[model samples]
Target: MDPVTCAGLRFAYGASPVVCEVDLTVRESEMFALLGTNGAGKTTVMELVLGHRRPSGGTVRLFGRDPFRDRRRLASEVGVVLQDSGCALDLTVAETIRLWLRLYRRGEVARAAAGLLADVDLEHRAALRVRQLSGGERRRLDLAVALCGRPRLLLLDEPTSGLDPQARERTWDLLRDRRREGTTIVFTTHYLEEAEQTADRIAIMDRGRVALTGPVDLAASFRRIIEERIG
Candidate 1:
């Protein structure tokens, strides 16, 4: 079964529709990227997939189940890193990771926490509280928490936004590892090069609609589509 499917998906904020008739399908273990200019409803689509918001029209399905209705049952199989860090501010970095590990019922909390921190290069900041960490550090912590369950479906929103080049590359390598492990990843990124280099397929959204969906080889075509739509 496809990991994600959305048909004629629609949503709005107080009557101003943000996602209109968006249709998408992500094959299992595929690295899919969503690209768009600001206010193009990329994040809104992610929210619907994650079941954080109900679509006003159309349908969203994950593994052949309703995401919003089956959200709790599906939680264990999915990992998510949104733009916001939802970690408790008072918790230390290591403490936060350990907490998620326990919630996910992972064995050997100490070892798991150490490994997760290392994945995001947060080992050095293990003792720092969430509120004490810089924005980049916090984002890394969020990623670690998301990976706690060894999820099959990973959703990332602007995952590398605040990182330096080296850190960003590390994040990419980590994601590549996940893909190799048969994890299906869907992400939204403004960096077209990231999509070109990492994604197998991509969908470009414009004015709340998906203007194009094609293989990464279609990067040039994507540019032309956007130009024709917006110009």
Candidate 2:
């Protein structure tokens, strides 16, 4: 089954329609990128897929089950990194990882904590409290927390938003490793170049709908599509 499937998905905040008739499918083990301008509904679509919001119309299924209804049962199989970490500010980095491992019911907290910290290059900051870390460090900690369960699918919104160039490259490398290990990743980003380089398929959103979707090669025509659909 596909990791994510949405058919005619729709959502609105009262009378303001945010997601309108979005149809998207993310294949298992594929790295799919959602590209769009601000307020184009990319993040809302992610929320719907993650079961954080119920769509007003159409269906959203993850692995053949309704995501919103089955979210608790499916939590073990999915990892997520969103814009806000929401981690306890007073918790040390290692403590935060340990908490996630415990919540996920993962054993060997010490080993797992070390490994997760290493995965995001956060081992050096293990003793620092969440509030003491810089923005990028906090983001890496969020990534570490997201990876606690060895998930089959990862949903990331602007996964590399605050990192330096080197850090961003490392993050992508880590994601590539996850993909090699059969993890499906679906992410939204404003970074077109990141999409072009890392995504196997790309969907460009405009005005709460997908304006174009094709292989990464479609990036060559991206500017034209944006102009045509968004202008």
Candidate 3:
């Protein structure tokens, strides 16, 4: 089954439509990228996928289950790296990861969290407090937490935001490794170059609807609309 499906998805806030009649599907183990400017509702769509917000119209199915009604089942299969790292500053890195791991059932908490930190190149910083971590390190920690549950579907919002070129490249490599291991990844990023290099398919959104979607080749079509910039 497809990892995610959005059929005729529609959302509104106080009678103002943010998204209208949007349709999307993501096959498992594929790299799917959602592209849009701020306020285009990319994050809104993700929230719906995560069951944080229910759709006002249409239907959303995750792994063939209704996200709202089968929330626990849905949560077990999906992991997320939100834009914000909500961990307390006083918490040590290991402590923060351990806390997140304990929320899952039958997981190798200590071993998995340690492996995840290594996977994201954060092993060296594992002893630091959340406050002592650099912004990039914090983001990596969030990614590690998302991986602890061994989810089939991973959702990342601006996964490489605020990182230097080297760190961003490292992140791209890590995501590719995960993809090879059969994990479906849906990511939202304004980083065109990163998407061009990392995504198997791209969906460009404007005004809360997909403007175009296809393989990386679609970038050529988008060039006329967007200026060329790497960051």
Candidate 4:
């Protein structure tokens, strides 16, 4: 079975539907990207996958078990980096990572977080307070924390938000390295370039439904888009 699978997944807040029936599959050691505009229900889909939101219909499975019902087991395997996450403002970066280590008796969480920060070139700021970090730096810190759990499945919701071009490239490289180490990655992003760079496959959503889903190779798709633009 794929590491993650969803079939006919639907969600709504009250009577208002946010995500329409969606089907997706994610495999181990592969990077999958979800792309869409603002309010396109990308976050809702992710929440359902993470078990933070219950599906109104259909099924979501992580390693062939129901995601919402097996959340505790899923937690041991899933590492997450969300777009907006809270960090104690007074905590230094190292301290923050160590505290996260305490949450799981994961012996190497601190070392892992530090290694990830170093890999992302944030090692120099390791002692800085959360409130003192720049927007990009804070985003990197979030990713570092996500890695602390040493997860098999990494779910990143807009992982590169606020990063500069160079930082974004570096983050892409880091993800590539992680995938090489056999981690399954599922992430959301609006940037086509980021998707093409980091994803093995792309699922594009529009108006609460998937508009396109395929391998990320832009060779033909970009040509079609550019030809239309030129015409």
Candidate 4 yields a Cα-based lDDT of 0.84
Candidate 1 whole-model C-alpha lDDT, 0 to 1:
0.91
**Is 1 or 4 the stronger prediction by TM-score?**
1
Each candidate: RMSD to true structure? 1.5, 1.4, 2.1, 2.7
Candidate 3 ranges with C-alpha deviation above 4 Å:
106-108, 226-231
Which stretches of model 2 miss by more than 4 angstroms?
227-231
Mind sharing the TM-score for model 4?
0.91
Clashing pairs in 2: none
Query: Which tens-of-lDDT digit does each residue in 25-120 have in candidate 2?
Result: 999999999998889999999999999999999999999889899999899999999868889999999999999999999999999999989989
lDDT of 4 by residue, 77-174 (tens): 88888768677989998888878776756777656767767976888998999999999999888888887777899999999999999998888888
Per-residue lDDT over 30-112 for candidate 3, one digit per residue giving the tens place of the 0 to 100 score: 99998878887888888887877889999999899988889887776888988888778999888888887888763777787
Q: What value does the lDDT take at residue 25 in candidate 2? A: 94
Clashing pairs in 4: none
Off by over 4 Å in 4: 108-110, 218-231
As for lDDT, the candidate ahead, 1 or 3, is 1
| Residue 104 lDDT (model 4) | 57
